[model samples]
Target: MALLDAQAIHPITLPDGTVYRDTVYLKNVIDHPRMEIGNFSYYTHSGRREDTALILAPYLGHACRERLVIGKFVQIARGSYFITSSANHPMAGFTTYPFRIFKPETFGYKDLPIKDTIVDHDVWIGQNAAIMPGVHIGSGAIVAAASVVTRDVPPYAVVGGNPASIIRMRYSSDVIDELLGLAWWDWPLDRIEANLPALSSGDMTALRRA
Candidate 1:
């Protein structure tokens, strides 16, 4: 319910020098009151969010929700697509009838089942990616551009390609596990700011120990 000032956050300036302003527009999905975007998130015109979502769209379509959870400090890029709903069709009989024509109470429209997706903190989703419903993206993961994510992405791993194959680990599995346990994104802002230099350097060791 509280509206934070967009100006207080830094703006994203495109290579063409165009600027985007609305924080709400940056996400393809959202919950409420959990957003913590950094300085340059941007969303193209084709993104949307559900509810109570936190987003950091440094490029485009930062956060997209589908009745799921996105943890703090996640970064998303431009041209990414997050799909939550599949178009409903009648199961009782074969009909191309419009949704309004069928009573929601009778056909189960009133109880359209939706699964919540979760994206943990400090994740990075690359450009032009697509995330399907009912999938969880773990903390500190990296999803490469144009990847089609059909399954859960493990924490601190790198995934890419049409079906999103694991390209490599950004760090050793042990290091990744340790960082997840550290959970630095949960720290207070002042504490995080004090360690900004190390965090920005991608020093997993320093971050984990900090």
Candidate 2:
């Protein structure tokens, strides 16, 4: 079955029969309810390596309520980090100083608004990319290596560089609309296997007819 299907849960078993472990081999991440990693999606991290421990793919979660939701068929390269929205201080028009922190009660919902980071299906995030809080990456978007994503990414768009800018759209608007409508990622395992011909190649004609 596609990894992020309705039936999917944490600790999904991979093609290699390796189970998805949180932070370490299926340890801390499995326990954390806020984290939602899709099926067949994986992250590669670079840090101190220990064979027995659960590898740390840094979530960079904030103190307030923040969430990281990644979709199916997503591929995250090593060093990719998510900077959640909860960590930001009030800086709109006002000074970027933390004057509110001095008063313990000032850290209320009004001061730090809750923003969740969401990455949609079939996205690819390259190495050392930093996704800012409240950034909603559309389905089939490609984040270029070393990119700092500060805003929302459109579906089928390719973005790169610091403060990530749009490189290009992978397909024409019509094609993208069709693809999004199809939502082939939500197909069942049997149907996916059966439609391999249309899925693998850019058989838009066949896909459209299907």
Best by TM-score: 2
Per residue, candidate 2 scores C-alpha lDDT tens digits across 1-210 of 442343333335679987655222222224344566665565665443342112222433334466677787787776777777655767775677877667888744455677778999989889889888899999999999999999999999999987899999999999999999999878776676677799889899988776
Clashing pairs in 2: 3-39, 4-39, 21-26, 23-54, 24-54, 24-55, 25-54
Give residue 9's lDDT in candidate 1 (0 to 100).
Answer: 31
Question: Which runs of model 2 end up more than 4 angstroms from their true locations?
Answer: 1-29, 46-63, 92-110
Global CA lDDT of candidate 1, please? Answer: 0.60
Candidate 1: where is the Cα deviation over 4 Å? 1-66, 85-113
Expressed as tens digits, the lDDT of each residue in 54-108 for candidate 1 is 2222211233223435666667676665665333334565864646547756533
Write down the TM-score of every candidate: 0.65, 0.73
Give the alpha-carbon lDDT of every model. 0.60, 0.71
RMSD of 2: 5.2
Scored by Cα lDDT, where does model 2 land?
0.71
